[model samples]
Target: MPALDNDTVSKYLERYAEPESTFGARLRRHTDHILVIPAQDEAATLLEGIYPALNAVSVRGERTLCIVVVNATDEARTIVHTNNDHLLQTLTALGPTTPLHTQDETPCWYAEAKGFDLVLVDRNSLGCRLPRGQGVGLARKIGCDIALASLRSGSSRAQLIHMSDCDVQLPSDYFDITVPMSSAAVIYRFHHEPCGNHAIDEAHARYEAYLRYYVLGLRHAGSPYAFHTIGSCIATIPTAYAGVRGVPKRQAGEDFYLLNKLAKLGRIHTARSSPITIRARSSLRVPFGTGRATHDIARNIDAYRIYAPRIFDLLKAWVAALGALDDALPARAYGAVYERASETLDPLDLDRLSQALLTIDAPKALSEAAAHSSLARVRRKWAHDWFDGFRTLKLVHALRDTGLVDIPWQLAITESSFCRSSPTDTGTALIRDRDAFETCRRLARLEERP
Candidate 1:
């Protein structure tokens, strides 16, 4: 085996030194798997999520390392300090630590069984230096970086990094699922149940339906990226994780950006195993996500809307024209291809998109097709890379600005084949009738498949 890159390790430690002391030299050099969970004042959620994970690892009969980064943002509203203290007290009450616990004077905790081990890092501890309000993005990044460090230290034999959150319930077979060697990431299926509030439950359901609708539209448009981006519903190999430079360090939408980059690397497999169950609750934790969107719907039911299905039709035509662009250049019909595509579009600002394309020098991209030469192939890849997932979403928004309005969720479904029957005018009726959302669920699942 190659020698571990000590310099790289040092850089990470220096950058995140506050939590470094808690890590110490406790990482196992080789274990069956490494799982990372980020926590922020989730004392209750931590216990709820950890138990099933431990149970899953036991069934696999492989020694595993479960690392929980107990973190909190600097915001006074957060109960991170209180929560971490409670977590430490709970760990102390669990049992005595193994030899791995001997090196740290800090309140780091460790407990192990025949095939399972748990490690806790207190982000609010005196030694921890994570910034205030860095949010889930920073928390997840810290945990994943620690996982990668374990792999490099030869403490873990596992190549995959399992990422999850505190609000989820894992199944006994959670760790039993595996991905093909060619896969970059494995997206687990997830289900949400009503949290007893009629209004909140209805809003959550409507938001989920919108999520599925967007994915279905992407699939229909022939975009390579059509997968879900839930933070807790994912697992990825170290190579892919590092290749993308780990997850982004943003307050929100970190999962979306990370998975977007991973999709460009290789196929993102959708596991059909037992799905994780997440509890639905309104939150303003970061900015936007399931929680925030749920809150939005509760406040104004009509405020939450989806892109009209016709937008997908226009997107399909636009994406289809890209392939023709390459061939058209070879035939010296590049301008003809653009004019033809412009005529087919309904709401797209053909002039604006065309201007954007020209600014990127689309002709140079066409002449540099990979099938043509080595240099051409590199140029072609760069060109495609330029028009990434974020850009595509921007284009969609641009169309929205140019008169393509977002329709109400219920209306969008009723207008399409996805919902054979319409629900009551209010979202409550549609949410209560589980069957009404089946089409959206099925379509999302279809897009999930490899």
Candidate 2:
């Protein structure tokens, strides 16, 4: 096993790091459409993806494109970006590449950058890069903020806007597909797929356990702070997004929240349109509740951790049931976590919220419970939703790199020692596989357009 030392990060950097490969070489890169990827740290994975994703976008046709990185941190910004000359030389080294503008900066700066038409942000930094305020919802809000700023700055118009997590990997044709899929406001239900996860160590197991325990254990479905937003991976029309005003920048569940507000602005359109090929997550770090979000929701009576959808009643359940499960828990007092959550969430807004979840096709059971149950009754059920979160994931990202798949020296990844559980084994593999994905992607392509 590779030691988890500097050597570990280094080894992956040197050997396992995904650079150019035959698979990547063949993939397309589009230059016409601007692909704004707002992320932080994500160096390793970004390095793996940037080139191919660029190539993929370039495939459709040649157009001026930019990969804007709304880098939150200073150090990472320096490493990921280069001055104009260095960037040009790097492009020259890559040989026969199209014009790609890449910029890394803080929120205020990127929002005002020129030609940043399409924006895609990553929420994986919730664990690392961003401070407390800048998470999934915050990221989305920032993107919207930028769009608003651009509009105010008289940048003509900002057309398409998308927010995706670093955990996701985009297909070679996402841009082409997104061109037509951009709607006023929508939540494209993704078929959550899984990636391999066999290398789970003891700590890893506990982490996964925590996710399962926290999400499935509690009952309260939507904490006002539920931040049920899907982090990244949400696409909304630029004007529509700006029209909604702004979304709270919570670290988790940003997608769910944005979708909620978006529904109110215009017709909440749910389409089976062009779907993005996102890869399943590897680490269990960003599960429904990141083991960090907490609050007391029910009039200081109950507490619950909430980060997924339909979490109103579940939050109540956690508050009511905290004591019942306290004796069973071996770790930190679970009830205290609930207490904290209850405190953090905004006051219960049952009538308004219950009506909304139903409109989104949130389970009839949740709606029934919300209407019949008090605020406290629902908050408790959210405690252990992580398990279901894992089990029920639908759409997944695409796999763009080809570094460790065929290395002669068993370079240790998909076929290794503790490769415990992955999105594939959890059952969404076939759905996200290249062949399956191609089939799915083809479904979006009309009978005529190639």
Candidate 3:
């Protein structure tokens, strides 16, 4: 569910100073495409990392809108506020400002790049406001809403809002890629930038390895929702954006939740373009992400170990049993599956899942599978819905709580089949055996192409 209300969203969107009537004129009557970047104290990368990359887009006939939401949490101190001020100054200096939209005191300025029109939306401008704790998610939703509004008001038929981050360098042909109409969202290829610092670089490598390992483990468990959820790697259809009620307003994991919802709507494709380069660094922006993982791992390398491989085995068994859900395998039998998946859960708690399955009528609710006049359809649908990524993660935690230990980075690497390296490896040694991580990432790329 969307973490915010329609009234609240409308209010936040109303902060855009440009009237709908003026969107056409500002877009040069050609706002057929848009890119939304949520900036929070990213002045260092905004000019060097993102701007020049955006300048390289050579797509013609499609009017492009680049919306930069310059914002910070309401509780932000001087440093954050100052960085935003500098970012705004840098954007303003990009070219002569042609004002388009304004909310309260924050005016959205129009600046021209080579072939794209830049709309700088400064949330920190005087009188502009947003609730506390509404971070990048809110910034993204606001920018997308503006794009949607502009599309609805103009002659353009733009249907996609490409979401990117300031820390990543976009490909020169970023805009040239097209998403399938049947799909609701697309995740583009991304690789973390390697800074020269050994400690930082090793931490990032381990963190990314963990990220890929989790997704690949889910794939092994037969999850349909197995995919990366990076905010900078996402693009969405306007209808899908509205269908999910826009991105959630959480301090973190907004991408995960948003993609989770979209996955149910339709296929989430992986784009097969040049990978966008995301800079690796320690950041306190949210409760978790690469930055937080990097910070935690640097402090204690073992603190963020991934789920045990056996958990995936248990998950696979549970998922597979869904198809064999005949009278031979009763609801209680399913509980046994959960018990094997995680020894931590008592028979009673595990039995509850069986009861829940019975209540949902097992695979009987799956109509598409019924077309074959077989129970196989029912089993597949039931297993998919019951064992989504969130539920799968929950099961892993239950195991962790019950003494299913997490392995160190090297062990996780071995378990994830990233490499045949010994679990005793540490630091740079573990990172060096990152072939499995890259392999998993490449396999993930197939999802975009398919």
Candidate 4:
């Protein structure tokens, strides 16, 4: 799961005050959104996930808008004092003040204490304070619910509200990346570090299985359906959030469902151009696949309990600990870093790109990513083939350079004359030669050595 508590974040806060430690590129303008975070008995992971986020958002005393929600069940103060050595050590170093919600009082007190421009939430909030609301959902509905409530109640409908699991360490540039959402659609998606091959492979296989069944099922005919969003990174327009009031609720996931609603309202898009590494680790108590990261140790429901969390957990904590700044950090010193921290976890843009992908003609930039990715694959295959002496050559033929090709080929002038001086038919025959095919055929023989 997420690593560090307030203590760990505190230890890292010094980096912000001293004059720009690492995170880069930020705004010097007045705070724009009233960041709200909903936390629960996640004391074990809070310091690692949110402590830095507060500092990163506040940017020291320079920016003053921040709201945090902690659910200690009926006991709020317990949520505030869950600080232990690890958490304290981190918090002491970070430099922001966290005013917690107290028992017997409503959660709305944050509005008075922080004067937040907007409220952001990460969990532990069915808005028990504002009016009448109470519930729980993650894997799918966690981020979706936060987006709905935060955007619906704000005075002007906040420009943006971010949500994240307490178990994740965010990127330092999280806000920087999402800042653009003030103007358009942005959905944040993390670049996950490699998770356990077994579980991930299993889950991936299951997803594919589902896709196959979905395609094969007699649900509808001639309707194209290719849109998906994960709860971890979804950003919708404030107006859009308000518009989709009656979206269906899933006991486990809300990502795709939320995205479907938003797509109807406006557009859906992915955030950062650069991928932020996300950790994937989980407590055994929380089931995988179905989606809930955490649940009651004794009695719980809704956990897929399929996907392993080890990779995500490690990556999230490392990202938060290193690039994710605390609310305690000075904006003047770590503004850029602060921006990076927020963007790391939450996305700022996705509408345009996501829609384009759905439409099948992605932007030139995304096209390049895929094209270059293919080239990279070719290079890798070539390297493997050459080194293994043709033993590893399944894709080797795909790696051949067009420079060696003839007959109206692009990129060169001196046709077969200056090159191999062979006929076009002969050239094709050489490439598709029986011996060449045999060499590659033998290469695919390499099996996993268990």
- Local distance difference test values of all predictions, in order: 0.67, 0.35, 0.65, 0.32
RMSD of 2: 18.7
Q: Write the per-residue lDDT of candidate 3 for residues 1-450, one digit (tens) a residue.
A: 112223433443455323332443346546556788888878645646655445554344455677888887667777888888888888777766787765434567878755667788878754564468788777877677777666555534555678888778877766656677668888887778767666776678778867776776677667787788999989886666766677787778888888888887678877777888888787778888888877777787546577666666555655654443332244243543444434544464455444444444433433323332345445455556555666667766665555557877557655554232334533344355355345445434433432
* Full ranking by TM-score: 1, 3, 2, 4
Best by TM-score: 1
TM-score head-to-head 1 vs 3, winner = 1
Steric clash count of candidate 1: 11
RMSD of 4: 22.4
lDDT of 4 at 256: 44
lDDT string for model 1 (333-434, tens) is: 356456666877643457545654555455554554533544544534554565567777876776666566898877776565333332334334335545
Q: For residue 236, give model 1's deviation from the true position in Å.
A: 1.1
In candidate 2, position 155 carries an lDDT of 39
Q: Which ten residues in a row have the lowest lDDT in candidate 4?
A: 18-27
Cα deviation at 88, candidate 1, in Å, is 3.2
What's the lDDT for candidate 3?
Answer: 0.65
TM-score of model 3 (CA atoms): 0.78
Tens-place lDDT digits, model 2, residues 1-450: 011123332333334321211111122322233333445434334434434544654445343233333334223344443332243233233333332222332211112112222232322232224554454445445444443333333332224444555545555544444333324554443333434432212222223322332222231232222112344445565555545545556655556556656544344443344444444333322334422221111122122222222232333543343433333232333334434445544445333333332343334323333344344433334322311232122100000011111221111112221121333443232235354223332222211121
